[model samples]
Target: MDKITRIIAYAKTKLQEDLTGHGFDHAQRVATLAHQIAKKEKAQVDEITLLASAYLHDTIDDKVVPDVAEALAQLQMFLAEIEISAKQQAEIIFIITHMSFSKELEEKVTLSTAGKIVQDADRLEALGAMGILRTAYFGGSHQHPLYDPAIKPVVFTDKTEYRKGSTVINHFYEKLFLLPKKMNTKTAYEEALRRQKFMETFLTEFYQEWEPEKANFF
Candidate 1:
């Protein structure tokens, strides 16, 4: 097997044990999508490392590892096992570390092209119709209220406050809706729009379901 594929396969084995909504399956899909768009974007980064990073980005998120530092250290060590260069490992870790919007809330780090690609792929998973489903699924898993009339969305300057906010609808306002604007490439931006539309549709349907006594008539 090729090096990048081998890296992802190894990571996938550990991640599959979690089996949560945004688990290994989600990461694989993101990596696949990123691969679809990577060549067109002229970000002077390594593609294999970027795609590998994309697949493993969420390994420490909600699935395999709960502790961020521990997860990263573990991932770094795994890369080391296969003779992956320190420089390449650093770049992959940087993207995985900074690519998260949740982490962004806690700390800010400017990402490289590889990071950008990985981030875009991850964000796409949260934006569209499918993305909206994943968002609701994740928010539900976290016990977040889907809609709160009183709790409006917050405009976050970075990642810390973003993680601090609750409510699934607020997630759209705080990040998903803004992702298209934050995209680093045209293809990624266009893909963002597709996902954004899905999110809007989901919110509309979700709120409509809340109409008191309306369901009785229909």
Candidate 2:
């Protein structure tokens, strides 16, 4: 098999049983989106590195894997076995490690063009209709409340605070609503605006349904 095919096979195996939003399907979507964005962007980007990073991005995520260190070590070996060059491997590893939203909250991460494309693609997955479904799925899996007027969204000072006591609805306020402004590329930025508006409309309808009496007030 080709290197990319091999990487896809490995990723599918790793994410096969994930019930959370970060499953193999998510990876495939990100990979496809990354490729699309890369093609549209005028800036030069390493497509191979971006696609590989997209596919393998979550394999070593601490949230998904019990032994992050071990998983990363194995990933490094896989890259070597696939005969990826040192520079390409470095770029892929950097993108996968730093592309996370929680990590972005902790520190400012500067990425290469390839990294930027991959990050944009992954962020795109967290918007629009698919974004809504994924958020609901994650909330259900973690037993977070769907919505609560009494529990307002907190401005997260750190990853821990962000992860703590989160309701699904509040996630839009804290993250999804802000993603359009955070997009790295122009194409992605424009796409994000459409998705962001969709999310806002959905939220409005959701609240209306939740409290029909208050619907007329808005």
Candidate 3:
């Protein structure tokens, strides 16, 4: 019945059909992470805006929705219809639109503390065991190879370059491994580093499996 409840319902409906790991469950996890990060860091943030943005962040994402412009318009209309105030709507829209990694590739947009919290939460989701599975799932869905030593990881500086896609293993180097330094909050940063280390361990085993002869010799 409340505005945040309606926003969650809208996000769930929009993201439920996604198969690329950006589903409603992923959004819910991000919301939970945002809440935890804010509390751990003792940062004063607008909870309503943070939670709403976390839930809806991917609803209008180009990766999730076919027509991003249309989705954005529909989401704005829904917010207004649900009686959310203008200032809150603006904050929510700004956070969701600018918090994405692809968007950051284009330009480093300044965000509010709440936006930073949500951004950190989402980035954290892309770093650990969950991140590895999500990367593999997305690559499988997009027809990207699991690993191709022939095709090396790229240093992408733009959305076009980033979205062109790369091998699943290469994604760890290209994006996921670099997230720890980009974290905004100390809590998120520490956790990101821990997750990054776990991913490194995972990759070590993957390489050992991929090159069994090398492992056998050792």
Maximum-TM-score candidate: 3
Expressed as tens digits, the lDDT of each residue in 51-137 for candidate 2 is 899999999987688899999999999999999999999999998999888898888879999888889999999999999999999
Models sorted by lDDT, best on top? 3, 2, 1
Better of 1 and 2 by lDDT: 2
Show where candidate 1 strays beyond 4 Å: 42-44, 62-64, 157-161, 212-218
Q: Model 2 reaches what TM-score against the true structure? A: 0.95
Q: Write the per-residue lDDT of candidate 1 for residues 69-116, one digit (tens) a residue.
A: 787777888888877888888888778767777676677788877787
Estimate every model's Cα lDDT from 0 to 1: 0.76, 0.90, 0.93
Q: How many backbone clashes does candidate 3 have?
A: 0
Sorted on TM-score, highest at the top, how do the candidates line up? 3, 2, 1
Off by over 4 Å in 3: none
Which residue window of length 10 is worst by lDDT in model 2? 42-51
What lDDT does model 3 reach?
Answer: 0.93
The segments of candidate 2 whose C-alpha lies over 4 angstroms from its true place after superposition are 215-218
